[model samples]
Target: MTAFQQQLLDVNGITLSIYSAGPDSGRPVWLLHGFPECWYSWRSQMTALAEAGYRVYAPEMRGYGDSSAPEDVAAYQILTLCADIQGAMDALGHTDVCMIGHDWGAPVAWHLGLLEPERVSVLGAMSVPFGGRPKRPAIDIMREANVGRFNYIVYFQEPGVAEAELNADIERSMRLLIGGNSDVFLHPKPADAQFLAGLDVPTTYPEWCNEQDFAVYLRTLNKHGFHGPLNWYRNFEVNWQSTEFLAGRQVLQPTLFLLGEDDPVGKLEAYTVKKMGELVPRLESHVLSECGHWIQNERAGRVNELLLEFLGRHYPRAGIV
Candidate 1:
């Protein structure tokens, strides 16, 4: 595998730390990591794709890692995040590249289809499913649905509330969140719901994210407080308002969607599967067994296989340098 290259890129008025590898001439494939995760989250897949002869670009995202984290919650809106991707593309002078996103990144990728389907060659998402826009804002709906329950997204609505809980203990938060923190309110079971279940979140850490891997996340988040990451969840309504017109818009890109059987987030909305297929006309769905929310980590090998197959099908790596 080629050694990873690190650089700070100026994009969308923010300086982003991007890690990339593989041949510069190889077909470009950008990988996006979700909340609480850095480009390192795609370390395994980066090597896999890079070795498969595709240039891989993974950024720490605006709010995470060495990247710039703006204080305003509005700065973290969906359109801004999408601009970051486009800005990176313009900076890199590349277009028609495939995007693979996990967790929060999934929605960003799906939104790209709505925002600029022509900009993307294809799309792949994990953990989160793309259902059409809601009748009302999502946070409003989540508050009512998870009433007296431990819904993390709803818990994240209030400012400083989740930050206080998460910033108080970074390491513990990383451990539980990675493996579903089955005991936390983030888990579907109401019996385990607590005010801030992320507080008791030290029990389960997925194999891929061991003590060493988690240390990287802890140190990174410690450098940049939870304010920026938490701000991502804080912008639910703003993002809803920005892209309100695109509501119920169908994603025409050829897409591949993957999920873990044990992911509680997958069960949050019952309409994801039906809606995903309906919106993403050309969709290939796969669910890995014994996996949790972290599908790319838990099932790295299989995930790479699927990605290579899909990318190879659309953008053949036969003649590219």
Candidate 2:
């Protein structure tokens, strides 16, 4: 396996810790991790892609791990997040890339498809699906739809509220969230309930994540706290309003969408997948049965297989220098 290299890059006015592998001359494949996860989340995929002769660049995205966590809530806006990756690509001297993202990282990857259609040669996303810009802000829609219920996104709107609860017990928080059932996010809770209320931390780590893996996440979040990550949820409205020009835009790149059968996010986004054919003209999609939200980790071998096959078809590593 190619040894991974780590570096801190100053880009988009902040620093990002990037973990890369494979030959520098191999075609670049940028992996963007989602909320509460660092570059380490892509460990399995990075190794697989690197071994296949693809340069894999996975960054501890802004607001997580060793990456700079800007205090301003507005700083976590989608445009800025996408800009960070864009700037990184520029600094690394890669003009074209195979971009892939998971969870919150999915939105950034989707928007990058819109923001830099030509540069993102092919796109892959897990957990989240892009349905194009909505007519109204997502916060307002979520607010109304989840009225009289504890929607995590709405609960995260008020500054410092969710942060306090999540930061209080970093380990417990990570355990409950990473190993918790997806139904918790789908099922209605009392409007005033806290994020971690009623959820029990698992005594044992999920089969997908071992003690060493859990340790990395626990230590990373403990160091930075949940403030920066929660701030990501706070910027829904800002992202919606700022991307008005992208209202009808479609991701022209060859795209792949993967979701777990049991992922509540997938259930919530079933409509998007149905209509995705219109937005993503050349698209391939799959749903792994019995899997949950952490698709890559919970189903790492399968996820890597799918990703490598997709890249092999559309972004093959045979020719690039």
Candidate 3:
């Protein structure tokens, strides 16, 4: 743990702040964190992975933490996100590595399998499942699904609106979003619901989430703001347009999909499971009971165990280059 080192690496012209541990000579594992979270999201799982004979590198994606954030909405497109990881591979001098993503990061890993199939030895995604591209533009589809304010994706479509409201009270907003400060939407959401609005900020965070973890996100988001994170939603249409060539394509890499049974992702689990078997060719699935969207941190012990077992089963130490 104390051996972990934080440094900056230039990938595709974007400088990313990356935290890495374990032997440099060991097989590399790219640990990616999703929206509203930074590299710290992977903190709890690092030690276990490292001990299991893995070299883990968790990078604060562009627009999060001290990483370079491009202002152009086009910059955050899925292709660019894939390129970021490809560029990181190039910079690190590795032809490919096991790609593991949580939440928003899951899409990045899944798309990397599509865009650069050879660069990923295996794919492990959490919370979000890849059921292939949406039939139409995601935002348009989502907006139509819930024309009311309940659509957070649509709410994020507008740039400054979410930033101002979210940043006004960073601590409170984070407490609700990740810290479990309040579960306003614990009940079925209203027709017009806002993620941050009407949520109470509690003095304590969730049992799994600690003040130290909350503080890390608070400091990072307070500095960079939510514009970059929300930009991911803004690229829905463009990402679809760019990846149209991959309409029928499936992930050829061995895939591992894990999620919290209680996570909204469960709604699509059946479809995703079927899709994976159809397109992925090699797939494994697991759903931890009583868990939520934050699967990695929520169940760090099991995640590490699953991760090591998967890696050892797929790319054993003796086989690693």
Candidate 4:
């Protein structure tokens, strides 16, 4: 396995700790991690993609890892977050790149491609769809749709709720989110007693999670806390208003969407494929059977295969435009 090299890049007033792989002269791939995750989330992908002859860079989004996190809540706005991606690209002298993001990172990737199409060559998203936020804030839409269980998004908007609740029980919450417990919640009814017993039980879940990997994420957030990351949820209405300008803009770039069959986002009646296809016409979708929200970690081999095929087809090394 090729070892990863870490570097510090100062872009847009934030210093990002970048994990990079592959030869310096190769085309670039930018991997963006979602909430509660760090650049470490893309560790497996960086090595694999680099082996396939592409340069890969994964940045711990602001507030998440060794990256700088500003105290102002507005600093976390989606637009500002999107700028960070551009700044990262410019810092590396990349005029265009293949962009891949998971969860919250997906939306930022979408916006980056939409607003600055020339800078992105292809896009891949995991665990999230591309319909954009609803006309109303997600809270209002969820309330109207009667998805009472979606209260978590609203809870995140509340100042200090996520930080308090999630931070109050950091280890368990980390285990739950990163352990793929979101899969347990996706079931139609209460999971079997065995399922409940499966969680927080024997602690074997940490097998896939290394101590140093988890520490990088836990320490960063535990130091800055989750408030900054949670601010992404608080910007629902602001994001809606800002993104309205791109209402008709679809991500025409070669795109791939991967979701765990058991992902809550997939199970939601609102995230239907028809809706997804309408918003992103060129999207190729796949649902990993039995996989969960953390598709990359839960089903790394399959996820890597799909990514390889998609990237090969769209960003082939044989030809250059």
Q: Over the stretch 1-321, how does candidate 2's per-residue lDDT look in tens digits?
A: 558899999999999999999987789999999888888889999999999989999999888888999899999999999999999989988888999999999999999989998789899999898799988888898899988888888998999889889888888888888877875576677999988887767788889889999898887787789999988898888888899989998889999999999988888889987888898999899999889999999999999999988888999998563
Instruction: State the displacement of the C-alpha of residue 65, model 2, in Å, after optimal TM-score superposition.
Output: 1.1
- TM-scores, one per candidate: 0.93, 0.98, 0.94, 0.89
**Alpha-carbon RMSD, each predicted model:** 2.4, 1.1, 2.0, 3.9
Model 3 lDDT tens row, 161-219: 88888878888878778866214333347655566776667777877778777788888
Model 1 over residues 1-321: C-alpha lDDT tens digits? Answer: 469999998888999899999988887788888987888889888998889888899988888988999989899998898899888988888767888899888888888767877778689999888887877788888788767656777767777888887787776666656644544544454623444552544464667888788888787788788889888888878888888899878888888999888777777654776567877888999988988777898899999899889888876665442
Judge candidate 3 against the unseen true structure and give its global Cα lDDT, from 0 to 1: 0.80
Quote the lDDT for 311 in model 2. Answer: 89
Better of 1 and 3 by lDDT: 1
TM-score: which is higher, 2 or 4? Answer: 2
Residue 163, candidate 1: Cα error in Å is 0.8
What's the ranking of the predictions by TM-score, best on top? Answer: 2, 3, 1, 4
The sequence of per-residue lDDT tens digits that candidate 4 reaches over residues 144-212 is 653434345644666765677677656666766676566444433321222122455236555557767
Candidate 3: residue 87 Cα off by (Å): 0.8
Q: Which candidate would rank higher by lDDT, 2 or 3?
A: 2
Q: Backbone collision count in every prediction?
A: 0, 0, 0, 0
The candidate that wins on lDDT is: 2
